[model samples]
Target: MREVRATDLPHIREIYNYYVANSTVTFDEDAMTLAEWRDKFYYLNKQGMPFIVAVSPAGQILGYALVSPWKQKKAFRFTVENSIYLGAASTGKGLGRELLGELIKRSKAAGLKEIIAVIADQGADASIKLHRDFGFDEIGRMGKVGFKFERWLGTILLQKSLK
Candidate 1:
């Protein structure tokens, strides 16, 4: 695992677009263009957030994870929200766990004191389990807060302390 590079954007976009087109994991109604994808990272980079990707022995990106400000205000600087995406071919092989492990490690190293996860209520059991397995606890749930895939979707909030 390592920090994401400019070249990794294409693979990251590919993995993200797959879900945008076929899943409700992301609430984005449409796929982002290459330029938009580039823009997505600009703010995070400016905020000194960590965006990392896991690679295979041959160097193919297996998955990616990132942290963003839980809130942009100064008072929220101690916390971050995380997002993880795995290539279609990468799931079920512990790639997500490895990527997330790296993300959590980096977050702590960066002095972040808390990590929050916002997971889709449906089709995210594994994600919930992953967070819980790493010591996050379910803090709350927002029912039907997001509309996606022609239906209202809920979000589950989980939190973990870094210190």
Candidate 2:
């Protein structure tokens, strides 16, 4: 795993677009363009957030993890939100665990008070378990809070207190 760079946008976009188009991993139904992703990278950089990518020794981008502001309010500065996406082929390969672990560690090091994960209910069991394993407690669950693919989806808000 390494820090994601501007040149990594294509591979990152490809991995994310796969999730956006075919999976419920992200609520976004439309594929993101390179410009949009570049803007995201820029925003994260400006916010001093971490954008991490897992790549093979051969330079293949397999997955990415990011920690971004949970809310823009100054009062919420100590809290951050995290997301990790692994390519279909990278699943079950320990990539998600490593990536998320790094993300949490970096987040805490960056002086964030808490880390929040808003996970979709269906494909969330493993992710929730992962968070729990890392000491993130289940704070709340918002039932039917989102809709995608013509169906209602629930979101679980998990939290890890860094303080």
Candidate 3:
């Protein structure tokens, strides 16, 4: 695992778009464009946040993890929301655990005080368990807040304090 580079966005987009198209892991009903991913990369870079990627020996991006401002308000500067995505072939191989662990460590070093995870309630049991394993606690849940794939969905909010 290492810091993400601009050239990795395409692979990152592919991994993320797969989830957008095939699963409820993300509520995005449409695939994100490469330009959007670029914008996100720049935003994270400017904020001095961590955006990490796991690559294979051949230099193929297998997964990525990142933290962004939870809210734009000044008072929320120390808190950020985290996102992690692995390629279809990379799951269940302990990559998520390593990526998340690295993400938390980097986030803390970046001076972030809190990390929040807003996870989709459907088809995201693994994510919930992963966060719990890392000491993130369930803060709350919002039901029927999202409508996607012709169904109602909710979110589970988990939080961890770095201080």
Candidate 4:
């Protein structure tokens, strides 16, 4: 895992947009703009948070993992939410495991007390399994909490205690 750079935004956007447009893994409705993503890059980098990319030796971005504040409250400061995405052709290569493991390590090192995952009901077994493998436990299930693609989507909350 390596720190993502500004130049890596294109591939990151591509990877994320794929999930947004094609999968229920993320709740995002549209592809983020380059400018919007730049702000993200700056925020995570400046905050010393992990914005990790899994790259091939040849430098192609294969997957990425990251964490953000679980909530915008001071009481929630030690908790963070995690996200991971692999390139379309990069699935089943163990990159998600490597990336998520690194994310857990980095988040704990940053003084986080917990890692939370908000997973969509559909297309989330792999992600749920990945988080479970990393020790995240299911906490709640909200039924039909989201509407996308002409259907209601459920949300599963999973958390791993970092303390």
Number of the top-ranking candidate, with TM-score as the measure = 3
The collision pairs in model 3 are none
Considering summed lDDT, which 10 consecutive residues are worst modelled in model 1?
A: 37-46
Which stretches of model 1 miss by more than 4 angstroms? none
Listed per candidate, the RMSD to the true structure in angstroms reads 1.0, 1.0, 0.5, 0.9
Across 1-163, the per-residue lDDT of candidate 1 in tens digits comes to 9988888899899999998998988888888787887887887788888999998899998889999999979999989999999999999988888988989999999989999999999999999999999999999999999998779999999999999
lDDT values of the candidates?
A: 0.91, 0.89, 0.97, 0.90
Model 1 lDDT, residue 117, Cα? 98
lDDT winner: 3
**Candidate 2 local lDDT, 85-132, one digit each (tens):** 888899988888999989987887788888999999887688888888
Clashes of each: 0, 0, 0, 0
- Once fitted onto the true fold, the runs of candidate 2 whose alpha carbons sit more than 4 angstroms away are none
Clashes of 1: 0
What's the residue-level lDDT of 138 in candidate 2? 84
Ten residues in sequence with the least summed lDDT for candidate 3: 21-30
Q: How do all models score by TM-score?
A: 0.96, 0.96, 0.99, 0.97
